[model samples]
Structure formats: structure tokens, C-alpha cells
Target: MKQVPLHRLFMVLLVLLASASCREQSRVPSQAEITAISLKRGQLITCGSSDKKFGTVQFDVSCSPEAQTDFNLALSLLHSFEYDEAEKVFAGIIDENPACAMAYWGVAMANFHPLWTPPSEPELKKGVQALRIAQSIKNKSPREADYVAAIAAFYTDWEQADHYTRCGRFEKAMEALHTTYPADKEATIFYALALNAAAKPTDKQFSKQKMAGQLLAALYPNEPNHPGIIHYTIHTYDYPELAALALPAARKYAAVAPGSAHALHMPSHIFTRLGLWEEDIKSNLASVASAQCYAQEAGLKGHWDEELHGMDYLMYAYLQRGDNDRASAQLAYLQGIKKVEPQNFKVAYAFASIPARYVLENKDWQAAAQLKSRPNFPWKEFPWQQAIIHFTRLLGAVHLGNTAAATAEMQALQANHDDLLRQKDTYKASQVAVQLRASEAWIKLQAGHPQEALVLMTQAADMEDSTEKHPVTPAEVLPARELLGDMLLQLKKPQQALEAYEANLKRHPNRFNGLYGAARAAELAADGTKAAYYYQQLLRVAGAAKSVRAEINAAQNFILAHRSPQS
Candidate 1:
């Protein structure tokens, strides 16, 4: 060949390198490529690029080729949220492959998402039947077990899912990836995600995040920039202790793939939790900004479904910072989006808090009361919220001089008390309801209806004793008992008030409010000796408040001067 100019040679080399880069980018594979990549990475192999070709490959791998093709098509339809089409596809799969396990799994998965689909008993039974058939065909298939177990789990059948996951029968569901051929990076990433989803949130020692992190770290050690691993490490791991390790990893991943939804959502969730744990609003707001930017990008790319997934963290962060306007604005935006009903509970609860903030800010009980009656009031769905709504409504009614409404709300709240207490898993709801009843009684006392308050308080105390058989944390019962003591004092039942306060003090040794209430009740009972003792105890426990200390000292002086002459 003739000697080429150096510049021309350089241009030729540049073109070659550019062509190689383009080839790599254009190598996006079909579904069949997913399987092929799993078996052979870094190997150049050409397969059919069209969906029809992939369908043929899928048919080859499946035990029942027609059934497998139908099942895969159904799943693809389901992923597109075409429920009617997916159902038809699944039905065809079941018809062709009557023992097709995944056909049932597809139906179940479809029912679980979108939140609008009411999964009937028949559907559940069908799913279970399909799972049984699948199990018979291949007892080693973990995915079949997982699908069956998930249906059980969704119906609050935790015991069933626990059984399968513990027995390792659902290991395929927990696999890092699934492939018709061989697993690839995408498969691994998705597998880790599935595993994380299947992991229990309540496991004290082994959290979902930790399990996810371990899986990701093992699978993608070479790709430190992998979004799946980094997101898991940051969002799932307990913060502060692991934040140093996870934050750097997350930042690196984001730098590499700034547009990755996983990267965006994970950091947002992590920072929001960190803020709540540390009570650091500034850091949380910064994270929210990143989340919003990434979430918008995801939305623009027809990924609105994923965008809706993590907006709750952003909504809550705003709520925590007392930015009700921002919270309300964000909530409105979320509501405007399609398929937001799945997350309605969270968004509704945030809105419910708005009236609470209004109450605190304006002290406008009338406005708060009116807000409670509005449609879509979340308290109607959740017991704790209902209790809070009723309690605040009572306050608002009292402020508005509407005793009848207040009394009616109180009765309604009390009616739900027994049902609330029966809920074992929802302890917070029970506690809040109890506290609200106590508050209602206190309001009666404040209104100068001492006898009414006394009756309500006595009933609350008795209910607390009956409902909670085992000893709970003292903090849990303090609010109920504290209000009861106050009601007793208002009723001029000083002896009973003193007893309640003393009992609470015994449980919570250093509680300043209990000691103070005890001293006040003793004084009301004209027992200078006991009153002085409680005042002295109150002085010791009241760490802050020099003014309170001075007042206690003055009371002690008065008690000493008025000591019973017999003593």
C-alpha cells in the first residue's frame, strides 16, 4: 500500500474506534439475548433481533413450548398494564399448558399491582391451584413457590411465605437473576431487587437492605458503578453507621449513571430516612431536590410508573420540615398523576396532618373541625388517624362552644376503642385511640364537667387495664394515666387522683409530670406532709425550669408552715 499521510492515518484510526463504539451501543439485545448473555458474557454471538425470533427461542427452552410462549407473552402484556390482554394471554397459556405455573403467577402479579383490581377469592384459588400444578411438574422451581407464597403473603398470610422462604423452596424467586439461557447484568440487578422485595422488613438482625447489599456486592463487584448495588446499600442499610460506606458508593453510581431511576430513588429514600433519624431538615431537603430532579427525568422518559414509586419520601420530608404548603403542593401533584391510588393511604395521611398544623398555627378549632368532615378524610380508613381526627374535632367543638358535637364524637371514639385494642399488629393505633379518649375526658374536666370527666377517665383506666394483658412500656401508658389524674383532681376526688399519680410514678420513676400531679393532689387533699414529700421529689426530677423549682420551693415552704398541729 502507498504510504498514507499521518493526519489521514489518524482520521482512519478515529473512524475505526468510532465504529466500534457505535457497534457496542447498537448491541442492545432482544429477550433471547437476555438468556444468551447469562450463559456467555463478552462473547460475540448473533441471534434473531425481532420479538418473533425471541418467541421461537423461548418456545425451544420451555418444556411445553406453546404454553411457555403464551406465558411470556402474557407477562409482557401484564408489564404494559394491559390487564385484559394479559388475562387473555394467561388464559391461553393455562389452556395450552394446563400445568403452567407462571400463568397463575402472572395473574396474581397483575392483581397485586395498580391497586384497582379487586382480587376475588376465585382468582386466589385459581392461583393456588396453578401453583400446585407447577410444583408437581418441577418441585425445584423456587419461582413457583415464591409466587404461591406471595399470594398468601398479600392476604396477610405471612406464615405461608415465611415457610417457603425459610425452607429455601423459594430460592429461585430470591435468585439474583432469571434467564432462559444465562443470566446477565440486568438479570442480576432485577434478581437482587426481587430478593430485596421478598425479604422481611421486621427482621431485627437481618434487614432487607442488608440482604440486598450482600447480594449486589457479590454479583457486581467489578462494576462498582452498578446502580442496583449502590441504591440498595444506601437506602436499605441502617444509616449513620453505614452511611459513610453507602453514601460514597451511591455517589459513585450516580456519577456513572446519573439518569438511573434506581440511583435517584435510592438516594432520596436514604437521605429522607437519615433526616428523620437525625432530625436534620436541611440534609433532607437537599436529598429531596435530587429525588425531584431524577424523578422528573424518569417521568419524562415514560417512566411515570417508577416515578410514583418513591414520591412518598419526598412528601414526608416536606411534611416533617413543617412545610405544609410544599407538602400540600406535592400531594396535589401526586394526586393529579394516574394510578396514584396505590399510594393513597400515605398521601391522604399527609393531607390529614395539614389540618393538625392549621390547628396548632391558628388555634382555630372551628377550621380544624370543618377540615375533619371533608371527603377523602383518611381517618375513615385508618384507626389511628380516625382517633386523632375525633380528638381534634372534639377540641374544635369545645372551642366553638359545640358541646353536643364534641360529646357525640367522644362516644363514637369510645365505641371503636374495643375493636382498636383487639388489633395486635397495629399497636400504635390502639395507643393513639386510648390517648384520644383520655384527652376527651380532660376536655370535659376543663369545661368544668368534673363528674362527666371522672366517669370517662375511670372508664379509660379500666379499658387500659383490660385490653393490655402484658406489661407494655411505661411511656405507652403515661398519656392515658396522666390525663386520668388530671380529671380526678378536677372532680375533687383528690384521694383517687393521688393514687393514680403515685401508680404512674412507680412505673416511671423519674417522670416530672407525675410527681407534680401527685404533689398537687396531696395539696388538694389537705395532706401537708405527703404534699411536701411529693413537692421535694418533683424538685429533684424537674431538671430544667428554674421557675418551676422556685415555685416548688415556695409550695414546700407553705406546706411546712401549715403542717398538721398533731404532728
Candidate 2:
């Protein structure tokens, strides 16, 4: 492949990217209309693959023009989860206006992406420095002090507490700030987002997220072009049950500011949740292309981690459509990501998941069983990534009737789980535990221990039921209960399998494997009416993707032979 001349085409592509997506009506912010909803912070200078002004944010900050512009840029980056870029902007503000207390607040806020991951020890210290800078400046307004202090509360005793605890402190502080300035839109928006960041996956009532949604939803009409409101709102409803509510935001977010690679990719979170494969494919293609230019401009060689992240979403969308060839190509494209330093969470996830899904989605148990993590991958340095590969191997081995290998894989998974636990990484440790137990159950089932397998998998499912799936792949490598449903079907217990599948479908909703399995189970159980209903739904999403599944063809035949009123 010829190396693209990134620096030469940078400016030309920037203009094209911004125009290609976002519907920008807003402009550079002014303080006259402090509460004006039409403020456009994203008025950025785009270079091919890079944006001189990445975030199209509108700030309602009570600071000087220079400070406010910098603050707006910083907050816009934060909204897109571009913490490093946001913090840099914040640092520039501090240099430009040492007395700008809010710039410190911006710096602190930029250190953490509330919904994704916690700040590192170095990040926390950087946040602390920003706070100290704010404190030493005596000419700050009372409101500016509160803003800085709110973030300060988040970093207090950072090493002594856990990530969630710090997140809670930030939320508490934001609550106080919002209360103090009830009408301040920025305070209200930030507070709502902080609540969302601190939300737990099992909050079935989605209480905290619902609160964020209500705040964001109410503000949406007023701030139609506001990236934070639109982006955060999409996140607010990014779940299987609530995805429909987020469609408006998802449809609008990328178009509002396509310069940010993450902004280009954010909409797919909603699309993935709702099984909107076509939209996901469309959005990710543009996002990956946009990200590549920026990566190349920054001198990155093979895989741009950002581009790979978009590819992961794109691959899942293709897999849903049974486009095995596209998936094959996407995996081949991913192999080019050889350089290491920038291995982010998304990179780590795609590294394992792309291959794992390639085989697992086909129910190709033999391929999964023999899956290997390449010797070049630094397994110890990235045990979490290693854990994903092992989980797939365990699932494949047990499913393919290789009990000994499955048992070993399960043990390896447990060791990784323990390693995470030792590091106090509760969130990932929980996920590892779920995979570990699920693999063990599959191993037991392969060894003819049906009762034990069911119990073990049930327990794992119950645990996962209370939390959200990791936001890497579209969903879990098949939810454990869904796998149990598959196993039950293999045992010829269609009734039990149907029941298990229904329970899973309720939580996961329109997942391809779940929907297809439910249809097959229903047909086997002699319930042609329900079978037809599910088969039709599956066909709707499957579209025209090739590489046929025999069961899908069987479902199509059954549906055609006895079409129900609903079908």
C-alpha cells in the first residue's frame, strides 16, 4: 500500500470532513447571551485526520473571552472523551491567563472520562496541580472558585480510595455546584453528566442515568447543536432497553461535529444497542476513515487505535448481517496495527474480540478452541486483553468437546481475574469472573455434568444480569444465559432452551444469535406462531448479507410454509 501524504492533504481533508457530516448553525461564542443554546464551541480548524479545533462546544462560562474560548474547547474535548487533548487546551488557558480559575477546573475535569475509565495516578496529580493553580490565583470570581473546588473534591485522597469512590465525590461536588447555580446550564449539564459517569450497570431503574437523561432531554430542544448535551444524552440511553429513546441524539451527534473521531463513532453506541446494523456500518466507515487521516498526520504507521476502535464497531455490524467476507477483510485490515505504545482500551478490546467473534459468531467451536494469542503480544502487560483471548479459547474448547483444554483455559482466565483483583481493578475483575465461571460451566457441560453446568452458568448469568457488559464489543461473547440456551438446545430440551433464550432476549433484545436461537427453539417446541414472529424479526436485521446459516435457512423455510398474522 502506498503511504498517504498526510501532512500535505491535512487541511483539504479537514474542510471535507467537517462539511461531510456536521450541520453547524452555531458560531464562535460570545457572552451576551449567557444562556443562549445556539453556542457552537466546535468552530475548529480541521487538518486531514486532525482538528485544530476538535470540539464544537458552546460555553456559558463566566470568564474572559480568551479563557472562555479555551474553556469551551476543553469542555468540548471532555464531552467527546478526548481527555488528553482537553487537558492540553486547559493547560494553554492557564498559560494565557494565570488568574483564570475555571481553566484549572477544566484541566481537572479533562483528566477523567467519567463513563469510560478512571484517571491514572499521574493524571490525578496533574488534576491536583491544576486545582492548586486555581487556588493560588487570588483574583478569581466566587463562582470560579466553586468550579475549581468541585473538581478538587474528586481528586482528594486519590490514592486512598477506589475509582468509584472518587467518581462519587465528583458527583457530590457537582450536585452542590448545580444547586448553587440552579439556572446555570453548564452546571446543570455537567452535574447530569457526572451522575451518568458514576452510574452502575445494574441500576435497572437506570435511576442515575434516567436523571441525566431527563436533564439532557429537557435541554436538547433548547441546545440542539450542543455537543455535550447531544453526546451525553446518547450515553444516557445507551442500553438495550433504553436505546430507542437515544435515536434522536445518536442520529444528530456525529453530524454536529465530525472532526472528533470519537464524535464520529459515538452514535454507533446507540445503533449497536438497538441492532441498527446499517446505521452502525455507515457511521463507523466514516469515523474510521476520518480517524485514519488524523492518525497518519500524527505519524502513526499501521493501525490507528482510533481507526481500529471504529473498525471494531464496524466489524460487529457486518457480523450481524452475516457478512463474513467483510469481517474477514476488517480482521486483515486490523493486522496492520503492529506498533504498540498507544494501545488504548479500545485497541486492547479489538485485538482479542475481532478474531474471537470471527469464529464464535459462526459457532465455529473448533476454531475458537484452537485460537491462539500471538507470541508478539505482551500478555503480562495486558492481562486484560490476554484474558479476552483466553475466555474465547475456553468457550471454544468446551463447546468443541475438548474438556481438558477448556479446563486449562478456565484456569488461565481465573488467574487473570485474580491478577485484576490484586490490582484493585474491580470493574474488569467482575467481567473476568463472569467469563471465568461461564467457561467452567461450559467445560462441565462438555464432560456430561449437565446439572452442575446449568447451575454454574445460571450463577454467572445472574451476576452479569446486575451489571452492564463491557463497552468494547457490541455485547458479551454471547451472554452466558444465551449460551446456556444454545447448550440446552443441543441437549434437545427445546422447552428449557426456549425459556432460557426468552430470558436473555428480554435483556439483550434483538441480538442476532439470541433471536435466531429463540426462533429455532420455538420451531423445535412446535410453536409455529412464536417461531414465525422471531424468524421475521431476525430476517429484518439480517438483510442481504451472504454466507448462509443452515438454521436461518430452516427458519426462513418454516416461516414461508406457515406464515402467521404477526409474521
Candidate 3:
């Protein structure tokens, strides 16, 4: 034996170790191996026999045996929008079973929302880094790898892409994920949400949303208590045309996830859309309580943003129902909150909007003109928040017969629009600009330029018609066409005004404003039958309407004085 030196022996050992590593890398897990990872009978935390009935979906995943229970619970929580708890469960799995690639995937996904706001810069970076850790893990199944790859593709150029573009990529990836695993109901559900969210407001046909609705609706039979099924169903059908289709889910969702503030509030999306003021009132009241309770449990002294959000909706319902005393009281409560958590997106929107809603919904132009951001939050930091305040200001100016003031307020709206565009907030940019245009049309009408007003308002209506209303605003805010009808009525074009009112009713059926406007327009146009019918409907919902006593009296007199021949 040649007595080799120590350095030569070390080099030989290194080569041998590298060779063994390559051989191990060649041994990829098979489909059979993947299937073998299903949770054992006793592996899960028993929630009775049917976890599905308990509002939990225990999906099988190819993860470490030690992580099966944690993985299942985390996935169930994630699917229900319980992100905080889900992240905790995911972290436990990641700590105990570092080799479980999907644990990192779970943690990464906990950082992203497919339908809500896109991840902030730091959040996007965190998700990508987590996924990189997942990809570093070996012995992952093909399916698991595919899941990771899909998410990676979505975030591939996230920093370079606009939020819409990134969302489109994520949606496309989710589509691929479901196609690859059609039977994976979780994939199907998540993908449905992506399809619904990917559509621009301009996609009025709701082609993608319709597909989402079908997918979510089909899940109800087997997963009746599935929170995602119920919650996402409300989101899919949260439009005037489809809200009735979602009533069952909306009615059931709050019960299924009673502890979730969002779940408690989500049912009211449909309730509000369909003018179910009583139901909306009950839902948001419950939601406010739930949010406070959740905040207390989480060791927060102040209420969560969710509470403010629910309060805003509650205020809107109160206003819609002519509960002005209650609405004004709620406004005072909001204005007097010792502190507001405006850092949260929900709180910021609600903070800006609740006052705007209180003033604008009541048509109190003078109060709106005098309104200021009471919370003293950095309005510039939240442009959409600032935009809401300015919107009311512009409306107040236009309505009070002050074109110079209205034009000045419109300039503020233009500034917000430009800022939103600079920030890549395409949806709010378009929406705020539409609000500005609506005010501009009103200003033109005030200046005695009726034709110019009509042209401007018609264009505003067309732009607004292209999109569904954003849930953040009071339901009446986005329908510039309603203002078009008001202008048309002002111009004494009763037939045109009636058409506009009828169109508004088609999208926001049975609302007091639309019904009343249509009734008045019909009366002016000499369509006695249609006028009588709309007046009756107006009186039906008039119990909840305010500032319309004169209209209500007129409607009643007309209905009584002109009884139908049959009657």
C-alpha cells in the first residue's frame, strides 16, 4: 500500500461524497410514493367524523408524516381567511418538519391574497423568499413541486409588473393548477376566486365571474359548511344581477364561520346589493360585535379595522332605511373614536368613507363642503381615502350652485386621480376620475350649458357602466348614470331621464332614489301606468328613505287620486 498523504485522502473523500449525493438526487419520488403520504386514520385532530360538516376541509397533501395534522389545519384555516391562525399552524409545521416543502408554500401563501389587495413590496419579497426555501427541499412529490412552481411563476417578475399584470399571472397559474388537479377541490375553489378577481370592472358580461359562480355553487352540496365555499360564493354573486343566486350561501355563511368578522360581514354584501336593509343592518351589527370580540381575544385594546369596516356598512344600511338618527349617531361614534387605526387599509377606507357617506348619502351639501379629515391621519398617505372626502366636496360644490367652487374641487379630484395613476392603482384611478367627471357635468349644468352637461354626463355614465361598483363605497357612489338621470330631469328631458332611471334600477333595483326618480320621471313623461307602478314601489321602500317627504307625499297622492281601473 502506498502511504498517501492526509491532503490526498481528503480530496478522494470529497469526490466520493459528491458522487453519493448525485446518486441520491437521481432517486425521485414516484406517484406511488406521493400517494403513500396521505394522513393516517389517527393522524388528524379528530373533529368528529365529518370535518366537512364542521366547516373544515381536510385535503390530503404529500408532506412529512410528522406535519400531516398541522398541514391539514393550516390549509383549512387558510381557505377560510383566517390568515393569522393559519400562519401560526404553518410555522409550527415548518419548524417541526423542515423537509415539508408545502409548509413553506403555505407560509408563502399566507403572505398573499389572490382577490384582495396585492402583497406590499416587503410581503412579495417574503413570499418569494419562502418559496425559494421550499424549492430547496428535496424529495418533494411532482404535485407538490407543481404547486410551488405555479406560485413561483406568479411572482416571477412581480417587482417589474403592475399589480393587474401580476394578478393576471397569478390567475393564469391558478388556472393551470386546477387543470392539473381538477379533483383537488381546494385548487378548484382557489382558482374560481382567481377567475372572479382577474376581471376588470369593465367586464360587464361577468363572463369570468359567472364561471366562478358556477364553480363555487357546485361545491355547496358536498361542502355545505365550507367557509370558503360560502364566503367566496357571496363575493362571486355580490352584484345586482347575481345576488339572488347567492342568497342561500349568504344566509348560511355567517353561521358557518360565526367567529370570523369578515364572514359575519360578508353576507351583507348581497344583502346590501339587493336593498335588504334589515338584513344588512343585522349582519353588520353582528360583524361589529365579532370584530371587537376577535380583537379582544387577540390582545388588542382598540378595535380592529374590521370593526370600522362593519360600522361603515352598518351606517349605510341605517341611512338606506331612513334610520337617520341612528346613522347620525353612528357618525358621531365614528368621529369620536379615541383613536383610529388608519394604517390598516380597511380602517383607512372606512375612516374616510363613513363621514363622506353620512354627508353625501343624506345630500347635506353644506356639511360636506365644511367636512375635514377628523382623524388627522395622513390623507396624502392614503390617496383613495383622500379621494372619498374630495368626492363629497365636489358633489356638494356642484349641487350648491357654485361652479367656481365645484371646478376647484374637481381639480382636487384630478390630483387624486393622477396620484392614483402614478401609484399604479388603476381601478381607483378610473373610479375617482369618473367621480370627477360626474361633478364636472353637474357644474356645466349649473353654468347653463345644458347640452355640454348632457354630453359630459353621458360620457360619465358610459364609463361607469363599464364596471361593477366597488364594495368599498356606499352602493350609490359609483353610478354616475344616476347623476345623468338627475341632470336629464333638470333639463326637463323626462323620457330620457326615465330611461336613465330605469337603467339605474336595473343595476341597483328597488333603491329608494332610483325608484323615486323613475316615478317622478314617468309622471313628467306622462306615462301614468309606469309612474303609478314605480310610485308604489317607491312608497314600499320609502320607510327607509330620508329627505323625500315631499316626494313620498306626492307619490301617495298620485297613487290614491289615480286608482287603477281594475281597483
Candidate 4:
């Protein structure tokens, strides 16, 4: 050792350094080590220290330098909606170190921010290029592979968005934001928006509008100043019930952002839905005033101006209050100003829908059908519109005694049944489908096709399960079961109907329909004790349901009259 020259020693040291680099490149860490390191630092790394007692240690480090840190910071900012700040930080890191693949990955994450005004084609192309570079430097990390899988699933062109989001490439903490966590409000909101943006256009495609509403409900559970959410909700009035569902959140948002036109508009819409006519009008007026003030303060006016916000609200308020004349006047005013731009199919459709709604409310089915059939019906933009149009046509056909036409409409509905099930846009669609099937089954029963009717009802029940992934609500499933029970009773299958109704009642004890159905089946079967017991249960559960209360009274009187005294 002492005899070795200085240059020779330096050469030996260089050989050792090169060898170490090569070894590190080939090293692969065990799963336990990876998990331990990830838990400790909340970051994904390429290698983990080996356990001494382990027979073999396979460690391969694949992570690009500084990738973990960049991904974590980008994820934090993305979640917080700090897009500009995150972009700036990621951009700076990429500039400093091009091979720092995580920095390029952050660029993809930053590009997904909803609030960021979308880049031009050239800009997006550049961003895609950066992501490809990051993807090329990838290692054998499972987290990285997961990220790549997600990117492949989502952005087909970039493919890295999925990878970054999935692989713990972005903040490891944000892994909780996946679609698997249905109840996580923040994740739900993000996923809904992502899907809404990504969904394809087709004849019976997924409902972007519905997904948007679900996200809005999750994000602003009791508040509503979210402009994007409010806009989508108002535009898709295909589900009026959603307005009621969103009211509490909308009111809360309005309370916080008193100056927000959307905040005021949301409550106005909700009040109208709740049939609080006076409050609806007042809220709309306030929204209109605020819009005008905002316009003046912003020094904006006329059709192209960003501040011409309240015309839609004004129109809706007038129509809701039965002041059609005023609504027409406001519509004319909106036409004249051209100050506010109609962003989507919602604006023009609103005008057409108003007339259709009037006819429906007046029970003028033929008139409603005519309006719905018009070219400007906005069927493509709103699924509910299509559903309503068909529903109206069905009603008209039924009224006119056109059996063939009514049957044809029913057939068409069944064909598009999957679309109806997938809808979360409005609870009404789901309820309507159930009722429609039940009605169709009743018609079949009347025609001496009781078995066919039962089959149809069963199909309807299955559809309910297909759409809603969560635990089936007793309220929803019970009605369908009770309807089936009635059909079975009509078919002279009282024992089967009794069993069905009893099962339904077990799940929904307080349901008047379930109790009544069971009672009817028992009575028809000549089971006096069982009939009496079911009738008594019906009365006890009727509570405040007006129809059920009346039925229960009638049944109790009949039972008393029919009772016989025995020695």
C-alpha cells in the first residue's frame, strides 16, 4: 500500500466509483423495504435497504433523480388548485435539470388543473413532449408502473398523466383521491370533472352533465359559489330535483359570497323548485341587481361582455311565477342585448323547454309532444330532455288510444334502458323508469298477460341494481317489490306474492305499500289470521301517508264488518 504511486491510487479510486454506479443501476429493492421507506417518508423511491436475515436481496433502483420530491409538491398544489404556482415551480425545476424526470412529470400534473386556461395546441404539444421524456426515464418501481397504467387509461396521447397520478409520482398522499373512494368528496369532485372533460360524444354516451352535478354536490355540499358547478346545474335543468338537493349548499355559498351572481342565482333556482314563489322572485331580483352592479363596476356592457349575467335568472324567475308575458319580454331583452353569450345548448333549450313545461302542466299532452318534437329541442345536450320528450309522446299516444304507438315508445325506452340506468343527473329519471315499467306491467295484466307483466317488473328491478353501485335503498327497492307482489296476486299466485311482500316489508318495515301488498295477497289467499296481521301492520305504518291512511281506514272497517263471533 505504501509503495503505490499517487496516479495509480487515483485510478483505483475511479474504478471503484464506476463499479458502484453500475451496481446501483442493477439493484432492486424488496417489497418490504419499499413499503417501509414509503411509510416513513411519504415518498416513493427506487430502492429499499435489505433485511439481514433474508436469504436474498434483490434491489433495483429505477427512480429518476429528484422525481419523488417534484411529484409530491406538484400533487399538493394540484389538490389545492394552486395551478399557476405549481406550474412556475415545476417549470423552474425542469429548466435546472432536464433529466430530473419528476420535474417533467409535474408539468403533466400542472396541465390538468381545471382553473388553468387551456393552452393552445402548440403549448399542449410541448407539454406532451415533456411528459414523454419523463416516461422514457422510468424505472421498475411498482408505484411508477401504476402511474403509467393510470396515464394509459386516461390521456391516450400523453399516457403519463395516468402514470403520474397512479404511481405515487405525484404526492403519495393524494393516492387517496382515486375513483375507488366513492364517498371521498374531494376525490369525487376531481374524478367527476376529469371524466366530464374526457367522456366521448355518442348517441347514448355517459352523461357529463350528471357527473358534473354529482361533483358539485360533493364539493359544495352546503355551499354554491362554485361557478363551474352552478353553470352546469342550471344548464341541465333536465333534473329539477337536483336544484332542491343543491339548495342548502347553494344558500351557504351565497351567504359566504354575497356579491357572487352565481351564489344568488343558485338560491333563486332552488326557491323556484321548492315552489316558494315569492322567495324565488326576490332571490332572482337580487341576482339580477348584483349582475348589473358587477357589470357597471367592471365597466362592461352589451352582448359580448362578461358581466351580462342575470338574463337567464330573470327569465326563469318570470316563468316560475307564471308571468309568461314577463318571461317573453326578458327573452326578447336577452336577444336584443347580445351582451351575454350562451355557452352551451342550455341557453336556447331553456326557451323551448319553457313552452313544453307549460303544456305539460296544463295536461295538454299533444301540445307538449309537438313542442318536444321540434328541431331545437336540445336532445343531444341533455339526456333528461330526451327522456321527457319520449315521456310526453308516450302520454299523448296513450291519451289518443294509439296502442301501437304507445307500445312502440315503450319498446324504444327499453332499448335505451342502460342509458336510463347510468343517469345520476336526476333522481326523477330513475323514479320515472320504475313507474313506467310498473304501469306497463299493469297494462299487461289488464290484457290477461300477468306473467309477461311480472317479467317486465323483474327487468325493471334489475335495471335499478345496474345503475346504483352502492347498497340499494329500501325506499327505492321496496316499491318495485310491492308492485311485483301485486302482479303476482293478480296472476292468482297469492302465496308467491305474499312471500315477496313479506320479504320487502322486512327490509322496509315502515312502507305502507309493502304492508298493503302483503295484506292484499294474504286476503286473496283466504288466510284470515295472516290477512288481519298484515292489515294491522299497514295501519300502524301508514302514519301520515294520506292515501295509505284512507286505505287503512277502509280495510279496518271491512275487517270489522267481516269478522264472525264464534262460541
The TM-scores of all predictions, comma-separated, are: 0.43, 0.87, 0.87, 0.38
What candidate 4 gets wrong by more than 4 Å, as runs, is 1-252, 255-260, 269-275, 285-352, 372-384, 408-567
Tens digit of per-residue lDDT, candidate 1, span 71-107: 6555433432334445666656555554455665555
- Give the alpha carbon lDDT tens digit for every residue of 1-567 in model 4: 569999999999999998887665444433342223111111211011112010111112244455445544444344333344456556555444544545555555555543222333444554555555555544335444444444323334433343223222222223334544554443444454555333322213346546656666555534334433443344333223344555554455344434345445555545544444455556666756655654454344533221233454444444433354565566555445443332333333343344444454334657644544445334544444354455555545655556676677666555444454564333335655764776586557655676787888777655543442111110231246666776687678999999878865543343445666788888888887888887776554433222323456766875786677861
Worst 10 residues of 2 by lDDT: 33-42
* Total colliding residue pairs, candidate 4: 19
- Per-residue lDDT of model 3, residues 112-199, tens digit only: 7666667777777777777876776666787788888877866788878876776677789889989998888888888887776677
Off by over 4 Å in 3: 2-54, 64-66, 474-478, 542-551, 563-567
lDDT of 1: 0.49
In order, the Cα lDDT scores of the candidates are: 0.49, 0.76, 0.75, 0.48
Give the local distance difference test score of model 2: 0.76
Candidate 1's error at 56, in angstroms? 24
Model 2, position 295, has a per-residue lDDT of 64
